[model samples]
Target: MNNLKYSICFISFFFLFLMSMMSMMFMIYFIMNNMVIFLEWEVITLNSMNIVMSVLLDWMSLLFMMFVLLISSVVIFYSKSYMSSEINLSRFIILVLLFVFSMMLLIISPNIISILLGWDGLGLVSYCLVIYYQNLKSYNAGMLTALSNRIGDVLILMVISWMMNYGSWNYIFYLDFMNNDLVMMMISFMIIMAAMTKSAQIPFSSWLPAAMAAPTPVSALVHSSTLVTAGVYLLIRFNILLIQSNFLKILLLLSGLTMFMAGIAANYEFDLKKIIALSTLSQLGLMMSILSMGFPDLAFFHLLTHAMFKALLFMCAGVIIHMMNNMQDIRFMGGISFYIPFTSLCMNISNMALCGIPFLAGFYSKDLILEMTSFSNLNLLIFMLYYLSTGLTMFYSFRLTMYLMVNDCNLLSVFNLFDEDYTMLKSMFILLFMSIVSGSFLSWLMFNYPYMIYLPFNMKMMVIYVSLLGGFMGYIISTMKIYSVNKFLVTYNLSNFLSLMWFMPYLSTYGLNYYFLNFGHNLLKNIDLGWSEVYSGLGMFNVIKKYSMMYSVYQMSNFKIYLFSFFLWMMIILIMLLIGL
Candidate 1:
């Protein structure tokens, strides 16, 4: 049975890798010819509106599909080793494949109707994957993830209905022409809201970290390429309508806040998967903000490159977690690099890439993004957010590295950690290679000309300066002995707020549900267990019991009362007969 599951995994990997290569070839051909192919099938027409299913074959979609397939292929293969002992390995693999298929549907669809189908599919399947462990935490996280994305699903439905004004659902055809129309602007707002929810920006930001309840393989695929990026990809498709628009500014501010918030939150986080998840959130904010700034190409570039390293980061984390017997806390993980050298190498390199180290996958995109932000005419707040968030990225990355690799071992005395899982290591190597070189390759392929980032020396060095400062702080902070004073306790309220993502999770869950839950409690008191019982069951029982007791007392009357009643009846009968005569 285990062999069967492994065989299934290997077969799926083989097909996915083949498809990824094919997608890459097609994307290259499309780029060379500068061509987009749209195939439409008419499902029906209603009230002069043609409802058709569309497949858009463009360089962007093909490129994204390639990356999705590549990561998914590697993740599935990794799962063969990571999830080898599980009884439901086949079920888990099927759910992941379903997720990938959903993303593919989303990528190819130019129509809002089709997009919603894919959108809902992603949400539903993600909920399934998030709760794969069948635990309370996983259940809660799955609920959060599903409900959050459902908001986007609803917004997409609104966009679909609104698109009826154009007599079609093909948003691609209308996006360029409807920029100035009021109705179209409303549709754009809905689209942006939808995108924000999927991408977990601002108030919707709580779910991404909570989604860490999922298996690490799911995280590698969902966080890195498929689910979270779906929103960014949608916006990239609709960037023409959003550029210079009023909503774009709002998006910019919110996304900036999101970037800052997630970065700070990650620094305070201790869980390995969640820290990576928060970093994913931070990078997502960068992509959204940059996209709102009217550079879809740059956002797409970062999206691709970020996928490469982030996926590898999660895989390495998975290997470490497996070795540690599911110990996810960094506090308990020190000097793991000494035990698992290859996994540590991948982890450190991915961390460096995440921090935008020079010449890595992240550097090619993230550094250019920073330079572009500096070149643009932006306000001081957003500008500071961009750079501060960048520093925080380095801070947390370095802190995590120190905790896991540099410090002394904090695990139990008799633990055995080794790097002998060839299947997992092989899968990680694919992403490791991509994480190292995909940045420059994507930069060349995506852009016909490079961005001209003319900035002052001080401005050009801002990223490095902030990064260095963050790293210094991380080292100083991590070096503090555990026996020393508890700084977090000294500023308990503030530390708690920052660490809890400004209590965004509470706001999303308890804050939103408090009134409704209170109302339900009242209903239970007043209706289900109160007034309802009185008017129906208890009241009816009381009435029946009262009548029964009264009748029994009458029946208990003596023989004299029975004889008098019989004579009275005879007299009444006689009187009636006389009157009739």
Candidate 2:
């Protein structure tokens, strides 16, 4: 009976998945006909400015929405078996539904102010999802996730304020006009900063790996399709203004550094989800770098394709973790492939796709991205970061595969490892199909023409060469016999930096805020508790007490003081209204 109940819920999401597929076909047709469907309702107009609620249905939004719904449905179905034993399954389901709703709102919103509803919703919902397990790790991770994203929220608010100068918050309408105006550079910079925080770029990246405290399905959804992509999508939407700014060049450099940093961090990571989170960060950086390099369409293409494989990757990890009794450290995970061959197959396929194996989903976008990067007029530092990051991706993928599959089984001997979970497998198979074909399908649909590559043969095979070297290095490193594990002890400083993600977590959490915290403490002690109390609460009371004592006899006829107080109160209100405080 419970199984039937579960099936009914899964079927509901499956039906939505199929409906999205059908809608995608029509959306493709619409795009082919050069048609865009947009709707807007003016909510407020004041001082010649308009605040409107709007949704734009062009190829981008429809296609992104289709993929998001498809992934959400699969995730919802997969959660049936994955969370079947949970006491609060409804809470999980409701949270997932809310996340999907928030992402849909974000995807459809064409106005910055309207998008904030989705943005804040995403942050709040993600925090709820992350802390769902009700443990210390979950609590800490959730706080980090919420606070990191709050930075982006604050930036978006600043963007709204800056955008008011144009008399409208509908960025799509003014993007072209704003592209030519150097005066709007601050708004563009704010958008980039906000995107960085949400996308987990360098210096703001620690929260992403920390967010692995969430359940695997949430990780798959948030990291791949929704939360992380929100920033990239925003940049894609605002690409016209960004492309015209010097900030784009700065963004390009930082994004390349982020890709390199994340790839390197992934190689040093041992936690299954953290490794995958780092990979997502790496890919976010890739998309940002490519978009900053002036290819927003390609960035969006990669975004969709990455979603397919990465979600599958996390699902496979969830299966392995489930079978292993929640063991997540890769050091304790080995020989899972022999016990769970189906999951192993899915995992390998997703990893290979991540490494950009030809004809798979990742290859369709990633290879093209790298090719474009190479062809662009980039400096050696940026170019090397791109290629080295590619190699590092393969390195970590191979390392993870070696640890999880090729090594001896480190799990308890008494455990029963089954390769069968129809619910989980059914959802995984959905993603596997998309992971295989979504890349090629999107490429065919989105690009009417291919890019021209004039690179030499050696440059063309650069990724292949790096991939081979990375795979070889991963093998050597994963082996306990060949290389001494204590080599990191000798190079402890460098290894520690990479292992700790350049200490970004510490920096973001404590290092940057230490002085502020101390300063706040001082302010609390000296001003808040002492000076503020003296001046406002007790001190003002004493002053008024003394004055009242002095004026007790004179107050019988003093209406001027009352009149003065009334005028002062009115003046304060008028000032507040003027400044919008």
Candidate 3:
């Protein structure tokens, strides 16, 4: 009976996903006819302070919605089998449905408030799913992710409050008000902070690696495709505002630092999942840096290609881990190609794509980013940092692939090659197809007459050759086991510095909390504690004495006690009012 209910819920969610995609597709067609001018709708609604429900479609949003639907469908189907063996199947299905519903809402939100609502919902449901294992470490990781995301959400809320105070809560209002440089800069900074935290940039990134404790399918879903991508989607959605802000340079710097730092961390990890987790951060940093250059089209292209390859890597890794009895550390994996040829081949294809080998998806997207950086007005030092990080990306991509598949003395002896469940292999093959084909399809679409000029870089033979050399150099270095202490010193410390940058935002948050606490204390100082005295008169002494040993540590002077008593009374009143008492 419970299984029947779970099946019904799953089917319902599947139907909703289809309906949402169809609606978005209709919007795309409507926009192509020029029936909807998004800019005009934004301006008109700005002048009239009314919330508009009209769909104003654009290429980027449409593309993002398409990927969202694709990833969600795959995840939902994968979850059916992944969860079937669990006892609490109904609860798991509900959480999965909630995640999909929230993602759809996020993709379609037309305003900042609606976007934030969806963002918060997605974060909340993702946390629940991460802790679905109901173990200590999973719960800890979920709590940490929740705490960091909550900080970001509150920052966004503050930005919204600032916008509302300035009378610009809609995109139309932003068009009118963005001319004020100060307001635009502040909003841009806040939005970037929200994006960085959500995308697991720098210090906030530890939670992502920790999240590998989740079920393999959940990792494939949240880490590879949907939830983390929301950050990049938000940045793309507000590209116009970002372009106007002076913060683009800062965004570029942060992205470079994040990429270099995460690349170093990836090198130090032995766990296969954690290596991929760190690589995701580095790759995302690369994408964000590219987007920071005001090229939405290139950024989205990279995003699309990255999704394909990253998903393939994670799913194939899952298959291997499952085959080997859930052993994920690379130290215990070796010569896997001999046993699971199909899985190894799929991983190698993804590895080549990830490292940007010539003619692959990564070569197309990453080479464009590198070429764009060369033309930017950014300092040469910054450019070199990104260049060096790209080399590291190639290095670790080779390290992960070789350490698992190649026949070496250090390789584990007891590796298994077969995936008993064909479901996993089928998912892997689908991703493999996408990884190989997406780049050419996108290149064809954008290189045609109408959009040709918008193509940022020439996909020439020279660029491909250089990228392939970089990747091959990395592979050779890994295979030869070259030990360079100088490389270690520079890269490792850079990562620490980037990780330390997270403290700035955290310190800001702490100061804000302290100020609010102080203000609350001051506001409650004049309140009387007469009710507290009354309650204390009724056997309260006996109650206190019963726990005197524990209460002793909390005891304070008479004035402090009076302040605490007054604050307690005020809280009770506030709670009463909030609950409509």
Q: Rate the local accuracy (lDDT) of all candidates.
A: 0.93, 0.88, 0.71
For all candidates, what are the clash counts? Answer: 0, 0, 0
lDDT of 3 by residue, 1-581 (tens): 76685576468547756864785576457556644345323323456576544334555556566666665566555556555667776677677668766776666655677677778997898888888888898887788778878877987897778777566456434644465567667877898889888887765665677777777767776766577878887888778878877777788888888888777667767688878888888888887888888887788888878887887788778777876767877766777787788888989999889888767777777777777677667787777777778777777777777778873624356644454455556657767887888787766644444432233344234345444555676567557665454365568656454444334334534544578988778666633344555466645876777798656655645568778878999999999999995
Error of 3 at 175 (Å): 3.1
TM-score of each model, paired residue for residue = 0.92, 0.87, 0.76
Q: Please name the candidate that would achieve the greatest TM-score relative to the true structure.
A: 1
RMSD of each: 4.2, 12.4, 12.8
Q: What would the TM-score be for candidate 2 when compared with the true structure? A: 0.87
lDDT of 2 by residue, 28-48 (tens): 888789888889888888997
**How big is the positional error of residue 70 in model 1, measured in Å on the Cα after superposition?**
0.3
lDDT of 1 at 372: 91
The lDDT ranking, best first, is 1, 2, 3
**In model 3, how large is the Cα lDDT of residue 126?**
81
Alpha-carbon runs more than 4 Å astray in model 1: 44-50, 413-416, 482-490, 542-581
Error of 1 at 489 (Å): 10
- How well does candidate 1 score on lDDT at residue 216? 90
